[model samples]
Target: MRNVVYMAVLLIVANEIYQKPDMGLGVFMLVFTLSRQLQDITSKLLIGAAQFESDINYMKIFFDLKKLERENIDDTAELIENGDIKFENVNFSYPNSEKLVIKDLNLTIKSGEKIAIVGKNGSGKSTFVNLICGMYEPDSGVVKINDINIHNNLTAVRRSISVVFQDFGHYEATIRENITYMINVGMQVLKNYFN
Candidate 1:
C-alpha cells in the first residue's frame, strides 16, 4: 500500500512535469525505467517456470514407477543357512524375443565360496546374475538353494542374498547409495576391498 501511494505521487508529479513544453527528455527517461523494470520482472518469472518444469520432469519417473505392476508369487521358504546354490540345465530368453540369452546353463556354489564371472559385452554374465538373484525365472529347468527351487520360494532365497551389479552408472554413487541407497550414513562410503 505504501509503494502504491508513492508510485501514484510520482506519476502525478511526472504528469505535471510532462506537461511542460520542454521536458521531452523526462518522458524518455520514464519510459526507459518502466521498460527495464518490466524486463527484470519477466526474467524472474521465466526462471521460476524453468525450475518448475525441471522438477516436474524428475518427479514423473517416480510416479511412473508407482504405477508399475509387481510380480506376484505367493511362496516363502525357510531361512537358508548353508547358502548352497545350484542352477541345473537352465534356459531363458527375454520377453518379446525368441533369442535365448541363457541356454543350458549349469553351476553350483557351496556356502562361503567365492566365484567370479568374466565375459565380453552382450555375454550372459548379467543374465546369469539376474537369474541367481531371482530377478527372472529360468524358462526351463530349475534354480535351487539347498534343493528348494527359486520359483517355489523366491522371498526366502532373496533374503539371504546380496548382489552388487556391474554396469554403467553402477559406480559413481555414494557408498550408502551404492548398496541400493538403503542407508544415509553421512558422505563416507564403505571401501570396496576388491578395488
Candidate 2:
C-alpha cells in the first residue's frame, strides 16, 4: 500500500511540475501527510495482529483447563466428618517439569493435630500444602481425607479445608466483614444445595 501511495504521489508531482512549477510546495506537503498517515495505519495493524495472536493463545489455554476440569468432575457431594489427612507414597512434579517437587512422601495428620511444614526456598512445602488442599494431584499414590481419595471427590476436601497463603488477598474491609463474607458465601451454597 505504501508503494502504491508513493507511486501515485510521484505521478502527481510530475504532473504538477509540468503544468505549474509553483505548485511544487503543495505537492510536497501532500506527499508528507500521506506518508505519515500510512505509517500510523501500518503500526496500528501490526499491534492489532499481535494482540489477536495473544488472545488466541489465552483462549486455547482456557479451553484446555476447562477440559481437564470436566475429566476430573465428581457430581456426588460427600461431606467430610473428620479432617484426617494422609499422603501415601505421594509423588508429584509440576506440569512440563521433570524435577520431582514431592517424591515418595508418606505422611499422616490425624484430625485436630497441629502441624507446620517448614522448608527452605524451592522446597516442596507449598506443593505439599497444595496436595492436601486438593489443588494438585499426586503423579503417583494418593492424597486422602478421612481415607477417601480427594482427587475423586474434591467437594468434601474444599468444604473442610482452608489454607491461608503468605500472599493472601487483603480486601479493604474490616476483619469481621472479611470473615462474614466467606460465611455468607458458604451459607448461600448450603441454601442452593437444599433447594
Candidate 3:
C-alpha cells in the first residue's frame, strides 16, 4: 500500500515536470533525491517503531512482575541438601506460547556431576536452566533438587546452584573481585568453599 502511494507520487511528479519543461533537470533531480531520503527515513522510522514496541512489551512484563504479590517463604522451608537435580516428565512452554519448548523431558544430574548442555538456538537449553533455577515452573511434572521440588523452596535451590552464562558481564577488576561481585559472603567463606 505504501509502495503504491510512493509510485503514484513519483508519477505525479514526473507528469508535473513534463508539463512544465521550465522546471529543468535540476528540479527533477531534487524531487527524486528528496523522495529517496523520505523513503530511507520512513524505513528507519518503521524499524525504530518496531523496536520501541518490543521494548514497551518487555517493560510491561517487568512492571507487572514487580507489582505481583508473592507469598512469604516460610523460614522452615527445606534447603537443598545435596543438589541432585532431576527433571521427571517435564513439559514447558513460555507464557502465551502454544509450542512446548521442553517436552516430556527426563534427566538427572547427581551432586558434583559435570555436564555440558550444547544445542542450537531456540533448542530449550536456557529454558532447561531456567526451570532448574526456579525462574520458571514446568507446565507438568517436576524439577527436583535432592528429591525436593525446586518450587517448594526456590531460594534454597538458587543459593546452591551457580551458573555462568555465555554472555556474562565483564568487570574492570581482578578475577576474584568479578567472581564475588554480587556475592555477599566473606572471603574466608569463599576460600573454604573453593578448597
Runs off by more than 4 Å, candidate 2: 1-76, 170-195
Expressed as tens digits, the lDDT of each residue in 1-195 for candidate 3 is 667867887788889989998988898778778888898899999998987776676457545654655544554444465768899999999989999999999999989889999899999999898899988899999999878888887757755667767766534468788678536433444343333
Q: lDDT score, residue 145, model 1? A: 83
| Best-to-worst ranking by lDDT | 3, 2, 1
Q: By summed lDDT, which 10 consecutive residues of candidate 3 come out lowest?
A: 185-194
TM-score between model 2 and native: 0.52
- For candidate 1, what is the TM-score? 0.57
Cα error, residue 38 of model 1, in Å, equals 12
- Give the poorly placed runs of model 3, Cα more than 4 Å off: 1-71, 77-81, 167-195
Judge candidate 1 against the unseen true structure and give its global Cα lDDT, from 0 to 1. 0.70
Judging by lDDT, tell me the better candidate of 1 and 2.
Answer: 2
For model 3 the local lDDT of residue 195 reads 38
Lowest-sum lDDT 10-residue window in model 1: 186-195
lDDT of 3 at 125: 95
